[model samples]
Target: MKSPIAIRRGAVAAVFIDLQEEHRQDQRYLVDGYEKILANVQRLQAAARASGVPLHHWAYIVDLGAQDRPFHPVEADGKSAFSDKDDPLTAICHEVAPADGEALRIKAEASAFRSGPAAGELKARGIEWLVVAGVWTEACIDATVRDAVASGFRVLLVKDACGSGSAAMHQTAILNLANRLYGGAVTDTDGACRLLSGESVTVWQVEGSVPLRFTYENAARLYAEL
Candidate 1:
């Protein structure tokens, strides 16, 4: 079996996914206590910028003119979610907006890599570790993290910086990722900031609001016997 990839500061990128304005302003679409999530994301972004780490932002956008497709529940309801390109709904939230040179990618699917250039772009920039934060923890964030692992990139999921409407779902996703389904790690805002600043840190997992660090001592002992 292939061992997990270690996340080093130099090759990591801070990636903010689908932090759209509409999701923040509208309670119907917003995750509960999203303001706090936004704050953490902003902090991570600032830290990343100061550390000279590359930042990438992603937005969820639907093609308004596409035809011959099955109706999504939102479309069947005659409500457009992020369909209009010029609308502020589709724009990244101002609090954590993309900087002058940061790339902002728009995607119609849950995973940013499904149809966009995010995967290739990161590889081209020599980024092998992804520090990911964004909204809807069980949806886009989950999809992105899984695909990132499948596509050969190590992921560090920002636990406190991601928001989801359902708290249970959010926790479930975090546990799933940290359990090594995709060999991804989870960290809070402070840990991510520290990592961005070139500190070698153990990636932590959030379990019911408590942070736990991963260790190999038990496995190391077993291997030593062999």
Candidate 2:
């Protein structure tokens, strides 16, 4: 995988999938914290625009299975009890504009990298790096990152722009990722932008929120012939 040493005026772009009314309400509200991610999505949108990136270069709301069945909450004890009919998830797609050249792809699955036009689009443009954000940090976001890596694209998960039904799942998702497991890494929104901008830093310097760096030894142990 290749790294983005610096974000040019129009080279690197951020893609966010904002969950809306029906889609959010789907999945039995298992991915309950959709509202938590909106602000960061908006922030990233503004940043991408300021960086002169195109609208297609940014956000997408999952609209597949829309108008079919709405996501409904379930009583299951686990977080996956919710059912989304593309209802709540697509409801909160960012309000933005795009001309014909930009692409807003809809798909049948959670991870855009798996199918739809996302992979082909990225490859066609020679874009090999992705900065990802969305709800269900451990679900769709997590799935997409894994697929992207296997597809040969580098993924940087933006912490603040992603959320789960609770804090536990969110933190656990990040911890589970590190370099040790998913071959992916985590960073906050701003820090990711800085790194792509050639700021030359890994984890942020802040005290309470340093990203846990997974060592080569840790990765080796975790992935050892289990």
Candidate 3:
């Protein structure tokens, strides 16, 4: 593992993905420990704002009229099983809603960078790192983190600030991403907040090939550490 590095506030931005009502209010998509995840995200958001880091919010909004992707889940009334753009449930959860002057990027795909000027804008502003948090650790969070690294941004993945359908799903996804997160590190919300505040903190980063060496037998032990 690499030593902890300081993340300057000016070079870092906070990216929050899909903290919408659909995940918390709808049973079909509710993540495990949804409330705790939101609280952590809120703490990170506050830290970012206080420390002069830019905040970017991404929300998943599916347009029912658009061509359905393979295996798109839908209700009997033709509405999206997730966050349909027209449904009230698509709203960003009030607890973590974007404040005034913070624009919310609405995306139809899993990766937030796929449809927005976020990558370009952040680069133009000289952003070198992204502190990422939010939902569906195995889906949207994983996709966004991968794209962020591919776009030349180092990521500080706030693990506890992210959630999925279950603890196992979330931990497994983190393990998979951490194994290959070349320029990123995995830290919980507290460490993320400290880093965002320009504090150097030791975080879990990929070191050698197969650092985790995850297997079915050791999965529980690894998840506990994360």
Q: Let me know the TM-score candidate 1 reaches against the reference structure.
A: 0.81
Q: What are the per-residue Cα lDDT tens digits for candidate 3 across 88-200?
A: 98888998999888999988889988657889999999999999998899999999999999999999888899999988898899898888888889888888888888889
Q: Which segments of model 2 are wrong by more than 4 Å?
A: 1-11, 22-27, 30-33, 54-89, 93-102, 180-185, 195-200, 204-226
Each prediction's TM-score versus the true structure: 0.81, 0.65, 0.95
Give the lDDT of residue 44 in candidate 1. Answer: 96
Q: RMSDs, each prediction?
A: 7.5, 8.1, 1.3
Q: Residue 44 in candidate 2 has what lDDT?
A: 64
As a whole number from 0 to 100, the lDDT of residue 178 in candidate 1 is 63
* Model 2: per-residue Cα lDDT at residue 71: 67
Write down the lDDT that model 2 would get: 0.54
Which one is best on lDDT? 3
Candidate lDDT (C-alpha), each = 0.73, 0.54, 0.88
lDDT of 2 at 103: 60
Tell me how far the alpha carbon of residue 88 in candidate 1 is from the true structure, in angstroms, after superposition. 2.6
Candidates ranked, most accurate by TM-score first: 3, 1, 2
Candidate 1 lDDT over 128-158, as tens digits, reads: 8889999788889888888898889978888
Candidate 1 regions exceeding 4 Å error are 1-9, 75-87, 205-226
